[model samples]
Structures are given as C-alpha cells and as structure tokens.
Target: MKTRAITGFFFIVVMVGAMLLGAEVFLGFFTLLSAWCLFEFYGIVCSEDRKPNKFLGILTTSTLFITTACYSLGWLEAKFILLFIPVLLAIYIHALYQKRDFPFNDIGFTILGILYVGFPFYCFTRLGYITGDFNHFLPLGFMILLWTSDTGAYLAGRSLGKHKLFERISPKKTWEGFLGGIILAVLVSLCLAYYFQTIPQWQWIVTAVIIGVFGTLGDLVESMLKRSLNVKDSGNILPGHGGFLDRFDGLLIAGPLVYLFLYLAN
Candidate 1:
C-alpha cells in the first residue's frame, strides 16, 4: 500500500509536468511511452515457446509511434494509414520467401496491438493541438479524474462493496464500488472545474461520467489482456504500478473519449 501510493505520486508528477509543459516536451514523453507499450505488447504476445521477430517488432512499433508523433505535431494526417498497405504486402512476400516459417497470427497481432493502443492515444495529442496552448489542460484534467475514480473504487470496494461487478474478468470490481467511483469522480471534477475555471458545468459532468465508466473499462481491458497472455503484469517498468500500459490504460480510453466529446459538443 505504501509503495503503490508513493510510486503513484511520482508517476503523477512526471505526467503532470509533461502535459503542462506542452509542445515538444509533451510529445517526447508520449513518444517514449508509446514505444515502450509496443515493446511490452510484443513481449506478452510471444509465440509457441519461440522468440518473436525482434527486428520486425521494432520496425512496426516505431512506425506506430513515429506516425502518431507526426500526426500530433501536425506534419501529416494519413502518414500512419500506410501501415495497413504494407502489412498485406509483407504478409504475401514473407509467406513466399519463408515457405511457411512466416507466422500469420504473430504478424497480425503486432499490427492490431499497435492500432489498438497507439491510435486511441494519438487522439489526446491531437486534442492538444486543437485547443492550442490553452487546451493543454484537457488530458491532464481527464487523467486526474481517472485517478480519482480508481482511488474511489479501490477504497469503496475495500470498505463497503458487496456485489461483484464482473466476477470472472475482474474479480475485485463491484457495482457499489463502481458507483462510488463515479460519484467521487463527478465530485472531484466539480472542484477541478473551479480550479481550471473554463470548462462549463455540463461538459465537466459529461467528462466525469466518461472517465469513471471508460476508465474502469480500460482497467478491465488490461486485465483481459493479461488473463489471455497468462501473465500478471505487462512489465515491471513502474514500481508497484506494473507497466506503461498499466498506468495509462485508463487515460487511453478517457483521452480519446474526452477529445471526441469536446470536439463534437462544441
């Protein structure tokens, strides 16, 4: 418990600084984080007691990060879309050259993992650009809401929770705790709205609901990945936190959800 809280504070400080700095500082942080997530995924989804293609993994993973950074930095919009066209081409060529040594599922998983984690995350940076320097608070504020929700759920579950929300996928989760999380998130959001002093009441309420619900779902999604891989943690990159993915899973869903809501609602 002590370790989790201590490490959690350190992680929050680093992330908050990055988002507050904005521009290249923020982009560089995400670039490293996104790349690390790609590596972690490849490590988890290994094949039949055999090693995966390290070179290919690096290439595709870097592609995802670079394209995302470029898109975020306003260099190109469709640059990352090219990842799809080459996948088909390489799949055909590798099948012919390797004469069946080529692994279809492994290759496909690499592509899918990048798209799943990388694409949604890019939306946050895009949001940063949309709002200019002022919009920098978007992801930062959303993340705090996610943190608040998780904290509320953890405490509530330990104290008052009774019925489990999903006994199989997430045994620790409960409906009572989930509601507690939502209520806590909404209440904290009101406080943050006062601090930030720009986001309207209705939007802040919507943001709170999105973070509470999607953040929990994101936590479950990570658990599902671990359950399928038969592993407990993605990587030991963060002490008591698990991995980059572990820490940012909630933000992944919440970031894009907030981006879309603010984009369309306004």
Candidate 2:
C-alpha cells in the first residue's frame, strides 16, 4: 500500500507538471507515453507464433500521435495525419514478409495496439488543444476528475460494497463503488467549473459523468483484455501501478468520449 501510494504521488506530480509546462512538453510527453503503452500492449499479446511487428507498431503509433498533436497545435496541416494511413499500410506490407503461420493475427494485434492505445492518447492530447489554444486546465481538470472517481470507487467499494458491478470481468468492482465514483466525480466537477470556466458548469458536470461512466467501462475493457490474454497486469513499468496501460486505461475510453462531446458542443 505504501509503495502504491508513493508511486501514485510521483506519477501525479510528473503528469501535472508536464501538462502545466506548456503545449510542446505536453505533446512530447504523451507522445512517448503512448508509444510506451503500445510497446507494453504488444508485449502482453505476443507468443511463440504470434509476434506483432513491435518496431513498426511503435513507429506507426508515434507517428500518428505526433501528426495529430502537431495538427492540433496548428504546427502542421491536417493532411499530415493522412501519413498515418500509409504507415499502417506499411505495417500490413511488412507482415507479408514475415514467416509466421498466423501473420494476419499478428497484424491484427498490431493494429489493435494502435487503435486501442495510440488513438485514445491522441484524443487526450487533443483535449489540451480543443479550444484552439493550449489551455492545460481542460486536460488537467479531466484527469483530476478521473482520479477522484477512481479514488471514490475504491474507497466506497472497500467500505460499503455488496453487489458486484461486473463480476465476470472485474469481481472487485461493486455497484456501490460505481455510484460513489459518479457522485465524487460530480462533486469535483463543481470545483473544476469554478476555477476553469473554459467550458460551462453544466458541461463540466457532464464531463464528470462521462468520466465516471466511460472511465469505468474503459477499466473493464482493459480488464477484459487481460483476462483474455491470461495476464495479471499489462507490465511492471509502474511498480505498484502495473504498467502504463493499467494506469491510463480509463483515459483510453473516456478521453475519446470527452473529446467528442467538447468538440461537437464547441
């Protein structure tokens, strides 16, 4: 528990500091982070006969993230993102030369890593630049709500949990915990709205609700992935936190949802 708490504290500090630094640092940090997460994803699914083209996968994902981030920052045209298509095609072409029996399966996992890990981080990066400027508060506020929701759920589940939320996928989660997450996230949204009025108060509340709901779904999705892969954690990169994927899985689903909401509403 102490190790977990320590790791969480440092992780939060580094994340908050990077985001608050500026747009370039924010993009650079998450760009590497997304790549690292992709690497971890590949590691989890690889086997004797199924080996994803990790180099190509990481390269392609990093390219995608960098292009999207550059476009968001107004440093590159939207067409640069089209480059990602060709890189993905290259992954397919590269797989054609490999002597694996299940080449297509490997290719599928590679692309899945890109979509599952890279795309969402791209969306999270976009959150910082959603307002046509580098406003750190939006992304930071979203993360704050996410953390609060997770904390609330854990605490509530431990103290008052009874019925399981999804026993099949995650036995530890409880409906009571889920509601606690939502309630706490909504409360935090009020604070976010007060300080960062980039979006309306109602929007923040809605974003909180989105984080609570979709974030839990995201956690379940990752849990499902691990269950299928027959693994405990994604990797041991984050000490007690498992890996980059475990720490950021909630952002994967919630980020895209929040991005779409703010983009469409804006």
Candidate 3:
C-alpha cells in the first residue's frame, strides 16, 4: 500500500508536469521512457528458452530511438517508414546465418518482438506532435483512460470478482472487473469531455469504450508473454508494481489506439 501510494504520487506528478509543459517535452520524455521499456522487454524475451538475436535487438532499439527523435522534432516521417524494410531484410539474413538449431521461427520471434514493442510506441511521438483546439488532449486523455481503467480493474477484481475473464492468459482477471473498469473510464471520459468541451460526448463515449476494451487485451498480451517466459513478474523496478513495463503495458498498447481514434475523429 505504501509502495503503491508513493509510486502513484510520483507518476502523477511527472505526468502532470509533462502534460502542462507542452508536446515536445512530453515527446522527449516519453521517447526515453519507451526506449527503456523496449530494452527491458527485449532483455526479458532473450532470457526465455530461445536466445533472441542480441545484435538485432540493439539495432532495433537504436533505430526506434532515432526514428522517434526524428518524429518528435517533426522531420523524416516518410524516411522512417522506409526504415522498416531494412529491419525486415536484416532479420531474414540473420536467420539464414543462425539456422543450426531452430530455423526461421526464432528470427520471426525477434522481428515480431522488436517491431511490436517499438513501432507502436513511436506512435506516441506522433500523437504528442499534434496541436489542436483541446490543447492536444490526445495523449493526456489516453493516459487518463488507461490509468483509471487499470485502477478500476484492480479494485473491482479484488472486491467482487467471481468469473474468470481469461484463465489461460490471466488467471486473476474477471469479467466483472473488466466491465467495472470500462464503466469507470466512461464516466471519467464523460467528465473530461464536458470540462474540455472538445469533441462531442459521443466521441468521448467511443473513446472510453474502445480504450477500456483494448487496454485489457494489451495487458493480457504482456501477461501471456510473461507466462510463456515462465516468469512471475516482468521486472522489479517498481515496488508493489512489478516494473514500468508491467504497470504500463496496457497504456503502451492503448495509447496508439487512442491516438488513432482521436486523429480520425478530428
């Protein structure tokens, strides 16, 4: 409880500061955080049964950092898109060289792991770069939805959770908790939507609806990864919470999704 409180307080302070400052600052900080998280994810994956390509890991992480830096400073978006092809080709060529044991699947896993964690996070830079009537609520609003949903799910699951949501991937998750989280997120979204007077209430409703649902999928994806890796927690950086990745996995997944929704709505 103490651990959670302190971490929560620090997280709120930093995020609030970032939100108040401006998009570029947030982009810079978020890029660093996402890079660290990517490195952590790759490290954890490589620790699993199959050894992932370390050189490829470094390459992907470096490319992602540079790409995000470019996007944050508002340059080379088209050029960065082209960067993906070379990554793919490198993975294939490396797979051919390391075909002594298991064949292409290992390389595929490395590629998927890197791209999945890296590219989606890059979208956050895209989001923060947007300027609009709502003071670029895209990033802030998504964080609110993700955090509130996570809190709701935790509380609901602890109190009244009876039915399993996904026993295989997440044994502790409950449908009731998931629904409760969505409900809570919707109410918060409605309040923020009204206060900001940005988009219509319907859009806020849609935002909360999609985020609440997909955010769970994001959590489950990481949970499944941990389970496959046969680990209890992703990492132990956060006291009470396992790691930054463990805590924000859902946000990592849902942030890009919410950004896309806001972009399309606008």
Candidate 4:
C-alpha cells in the first residue's frame, strides 16, 4: 500500500509537470509513452509462439504518434500524416516475406495497436493545442477530472457498492461507484470552468460526464484485454500502476471523446 501511494504521488507530479512545462515536453513524454504502450500491447497480444513483427510494430506506432504530435503542434503539414498510409501498407508487404503463419493476424494486431494506442495519444496532444494556442488547462483539467472520477469510484465502491457494474469484465466496479465517479467528475468540471474561463461551465460539465462514462468504459476495455490474455496486469513498468496502458486506459478513450466534444463545441 505504501509503495502504491508513493508511486502514485510521483506519477502525478511528473505528469502534471510535463503538461505544464510546455508543448515540447508534453509531446515528447506522451509520444514515448504511446510507443511503450504499443510495445506492451503487442507483447501481451502476441505470444512467443506467434510473434508479430515487434520492430515494425514499434516503428509504425512511434511514427504515427510523432506524426500526430508534429501536426498538432503545427510543425508539420496535414499531408504529412498521409505518409502513414504507405508506412502501414509496408506492414502487409513485410508480412508476405515472413514465414510466419497467421501473418494477417499479425498485421491486424499491428494496425490495431496503432489505432488503439497511437490515435488516442494523438488526441491528447490535440487537446493541449485545441484552442489554436498551447493552453495547458484543457489537458491538465481533463486529467484532474479523470483522476477525480477514478478516485471517487474506488472510494464509493468500497463504501456503498451494492450492485456490480460489469461482473464478467470487471467484478469490483459497482453502480454506486460509477455514479459516484460521475458526480465527482461533474464537481471537478465546475471548478475547472470557474478557473479556466476559456471553456464555459456547461461545456465543462458535459465533457466531465463524457469523461466519466467513457473513462469507465476505457478501464473496462483494458480489463477485457488483460482478462482475455490471462494476464494479471499489462506490465510491471510502473511498479504499483501495472503499466502505462493500465494507468492511461481512461485517457485513451476519454481523451478522444473529450477532444471530439471540444472540437464540436467550439
């Protein structure tokens, strides 16, 4: 318990600092994180008996993330992202030369990793610059709301949980916990609206609700992946936090949804 608490504190501090430091630090940190998460995803999904071009997978995923980050920062043009199409096609071409069976499966998993991990982190980068300027408030505020929701759910589930939210996928989650998370997220959104006047209170509340719902779903999705793989945790990279994927699963889904809401709202 002490270890978990210590690790959690340091993790929060580093993440908050990176987000506030500037766009460069934020992009570099998350781009590396996205790549590592992709590596972990491939490691879990592809067993030793069936290797899925880890080198190519990592290369393509990293490229996608870097591309997205550059585009988000206006350092690269929109057409540069199109370059990924050929790079992805190279996966298929490489599969043809390999002697592995289920090459298509390998291809599929590789592409899935890019979509699952790369695209969402891309949205995270987009969130930082969503307002045509690099404003740390949206990304930082999003994390605050997500953390609030998760903490609320855990506490409420321990205290007042009665009904299981999703028994098969995640047995511990409860309806009480889910509601608690949403309520807390809404409250945090109110605070963000007050302080970060760039976005209105009502929009923040709506985005908070979206984060609560989708963030829970994101957690469930990663849980389902681990359950399917028969693994207890994604990886041991974060000590108490399992892995980068486990820690950021909520952001993976919620980030994109929140980005969409902000884009549409604006």
Candidate 5:
C-alpha cells in the first residue's frame, strides 16, 4: 500500500510538472509515454502466442505520435502526415513473406494498437495546445478532474458500494462509486472554472461529466482487454500501477472526447 501510494504520488508530480513546464516538455513526455504504452499494449496482446509485428507496430505508432507532435508544434506540415500511408502499406506487404498462421490477425492487432493507444495520445498532445497557444490550465485541469474522479470512485466504492456497475468485466465498480466520482469531478470543475478563466464554468462542468462517464468506460474497456487476455494486470512497470496502459486508460478515451468538447465549445 505504501509503495503504491509513493509511486502514484511521484507519478502525479512528474505529470503535473511536465504540463506546467511548457509545450516542449509536455510533448516530449507524452510522446515517450505514448511509445511506452504502445509497446506495452502490443506486448500484452501478443502474450497469447499471437504475434503482432512489434517492430512495425512500435515504429508506426511512434511515427504517428511524433508526426502529431511535430504538427502541433508547427514543426511540420500537414503534408508530412501523408508519409504514413506507404509505411502502413508496408505492413501488408511484409506480411506476405511470413509463414505464420493468422497473419491477418497479427495485422489487425497491430492496426488496433495504433488506433487504441496511438491516436488517443496524439489527441492528448493536441489538448495541451487547444487554445491556439500553450497554456497549462486546460491539460492540468483535465488531469486533476480525471484523478479526482478515480479517487472518488475508489473511496466511494469501498465504503458505500452496493450495486455492481459491471460485474462481468469489472466487478468492483459500483453505481454508488460512479456517482461519487461524478459529484467530485463536477466540484473540481467548478474550481477549475474559477482558476482557469479561459473556458466558462458550464463548459468545465460538462467536461467533468464527460470525463466521469467516458473515463469509466475507458477503464472498463481496458479491463475488458485484460479479462479477454486472462491477466491480472497489463504489466508490472509502475510498481502498483500495473502499466502505462492501466494508468492512462481513462485518458485514452477521455482525451479524444474532451478534445471534441473543447473544439465545439470554442
């Protein structure tokens, strides 16, 4: 318990500090995180004797993330993104030479990793620059709301849980916990509105609700993956946190939705 708490504390400090530092630090940190998460995802999926071209998977995912970062930073043009087409096509072409069974399955999982882990993180990178200028408030606020929701849910579920939220996938989650998370996230949103004056209070509240709902769904989705794989945790990377995928599962789904919300609200 102490180890988990200590690891989580340092994780939060580093995450918050990267965001507070500026865009360069934020992009570099998350890009590395994106790569690590992609690596972890491929590792888990391939653990069942299913070979996903880890080399190409990581390469393409890293390319996608780096391209997104470069584009976001105005270091590259939109045309540069077209370079991914041939590289992706190379996946199919390379599969023809392998004598392995279910090569298509390998291809499918590889592409899915890019969609599941890579794209969402690319969206997360965009969130840091959503205002056409780099400001720490939006990304930092989002993380705070997400962390608050998770914490609230865990506390409430332990103490007041009665009904199962999703017994089949995540038996521990409860409706009581879900609502508890929403209430706390909404409260945090109100505070974010007060401090981060860029967006209105109502939008922050809406975003909090989005994070609460979609964030839980994200957790469930990752849980579903692990359940399918019959594993206890994704990996043993972060002491008690399991892996990058486990820690940022909420962010994966919530990041894209929050980006959309910000776009529409603006």
Candidate 6:
C-alpha cells in the first residue's frame, strides 16, 4: 500500500510538473510517454512466432508524435503530419519480408498500437495548443478530472457497490461507482469553471461528464485487452502502478474525444 501511494504521488508530480513547465516540456515529455506506452502495447501483443515490426512501429509512431508535436509547438504546419505516412507504409512493406505465417496479423497489431495508444496521445498534444497558443489549463484540467473521477469511483464503489458495471471486462467496477465518479467530477468541474475562465461553466461540466464516461470506457478497454492476453498488468515499470499503459489507460480513449470536443468548443 505504501509503495503504491508513493509511486502514485511521484507520478502525479511528474505529470503536473511537466504540464506546468511550459509548452516545450509538455510536448517533449508526452512525446516520450507516447512512445513508451506504444512499446508496452507491443510487448503485450507480440510473441516469438508472431510479432510486430517493433522497430518500424516505434519509428512510425515516433514520427507521428514528433510531427504532431512540431505542429503543436508551431515549429511546422499541420501538413508536416504527412511525414508519418511513409514510415507507416514502411511497416506493411517491412512485414512482407519477415516471412511470418501471420504477417497481416502482425501488421494489424502494429497499426492498432498506433491508433489505440499513439493517436490519442497525438490529440492530447494538440489539446495543449488548440487555441493557437499553448495554454496548460485545458490539458491539466483533463488530467485532474480523470484522476478525480477515478478516485471518486474507487471510494464510492468500495463503500456502496453492489451491482457490477461490467463483470465480464472489469469485475470490480460498479454502476454505483460510475455514478459516484460522475458526481465528483461534476463538482470538480464547477471549481475549474470558477477558477479557469478560459472555458465556460457548462462546458467544464460537460467535459467532466465526457471524462467520467469515456475514461471508464478506456479503463475497461485496457482491462479487456489484458484479460484477453491473460496477463495481470501491462508492465511493472511504475512499481505498484503496473505499467505506463495501466496508469494512462483512462487517457487512451477519453483523450481523443476530449480533444475533439475542446477543439470544436474553441
């Protein structure tokens, strides 16, 4: 318990600190973070006989992320994102020569790593610079809402949970916990609306709702992945936190949606 708490504390610190540091730090930090998460995803899916072209996958993903970062940082135009296409195409071409039985399966999972893990993080970087100027509050607020929702659900579920939310995917989650997350997230959104005038009150509340719903979905999706793979955790890099994927799974699905909403909102 102490180890989990300690790891979580530092995790929060690094996350919050990176955002508060400014645009470059936020972009640089998350760029590496995106790559690490993709690497973990590949590790989970790959085996000896069937495996992704990890070198190409990472190269393609990193290219996409770096291009996204460049655009977000105003170093290049959005058209620079096209640079990822060639590297991505390289994945398919490279797979042909590997002579594996399930080459397409390998290719499919490689791309899945990008869509499932990489693209959302790309959207995440865009969120910080959505307004043409880097404002940390939007991205930071997203994390705060996600963390708050998770905490609320855990507490409420432990105390009042009865009916399971998705027993097949995640046995511990409950409908009661879901509602608890929504309620607390709404409350926190109100406070954010009060303090951060960049976004309207109703919008903040709506963002909270999005985080609660989609974030839980993200957690469940990752849980489903792990369960299918017959693994306990994604990895143990974070000590008690399992792995980067376990810690950031909620962000995976919720992030892209939030980015879309915020992009349209602005």
TM-score on alpha carbons, each prediction: 0.85, 0.97, 0.84, 0.95, 0.96, 0.97
lDDT of 2: 0.92
RMSD of each: 3.0, 1.2, 2.9, 1.4, 1.4, 1.1
Model 6 per-residue lDDT tens digits across residues 1-266: 99999999999999999999998999889989988999999999888655977788888888988887788777899999899999999888988798888889899999999999988888888887777788999899999999999999999999999999999999999999999998999999999999877788998998999999999999999999999989988899998889998988999999999989988988
For residues 1-266, could you state the per-residue lDDT of candidate 3 as single tens digits? 99889987897788777866875666667666666676677677763345667567557655766665665556767468457568656877877776547755567667666666766666655655445321656667778888888889889989999999999898999998899899999999989787756667888888888789988999999899888878777677777777677867786677677778867877
The Cα error of candidate 5 at residue 49, in Å, is 5.3
In model 1, which regions exceed 4 Å deviation?
A: 49-102
lDDT tens digits, residues 131-194, model 2? 8878999999999999999999999999999999999999999999999999999999999999
The number of the candidate with the highest TM-score is 6
Model 5, 13-96: lDDT tens digits are 999999989788898898889888989998888844477887887778777767766887789997787677777778888889
Q: For model 4, how does the per-residue alpha-carbon lDDT over 71-182 read when each residue is reduced to its tens digit?
A: 7778998778776677778889998888786777888888888888878888887888778878899989999999999999999999999999999999999999999999
State the lDDT at 200 in candidate 6: 88
Candidate 4 error regions (>4 Å): 48-50, 72-74
- Rank the models by TM-score, top first: 6, 2, 5, 4, 1, 3
Model 3 regions lying over 4 Å from their true place: 47-49, 61-65, 68-72, 75-81, 95-100, 130-136
Instruction: Report clash pairs, candidate 3.
Output: none
For each candidate in the order shown, give its overall lDDT on alpha carbons: 0.75, 0.92, 0.74, 0.87, 0.88, 0.90
lDDT per residue (tens digit) for residues 91-180 in model 1: 335544543454666557656666666666667666665554436666677778888999899889889999999889899899988988
Which 10 consecutive positions of candidate 4 have the poorest summed lDDT? 48-57
lDDT of 5 at 71: 80
For candidate 4, the per-residue lDDT at 15 reads 93
Candidate of highest lDDT: 2
Clashes of each: 0, 0, 0, 0, 0, 0
RMSD of 3: 2.9
Residue runs of model 5 more than 4 Å from their true location after superposition: 47-49
* Model 4 steric clash pairs: none
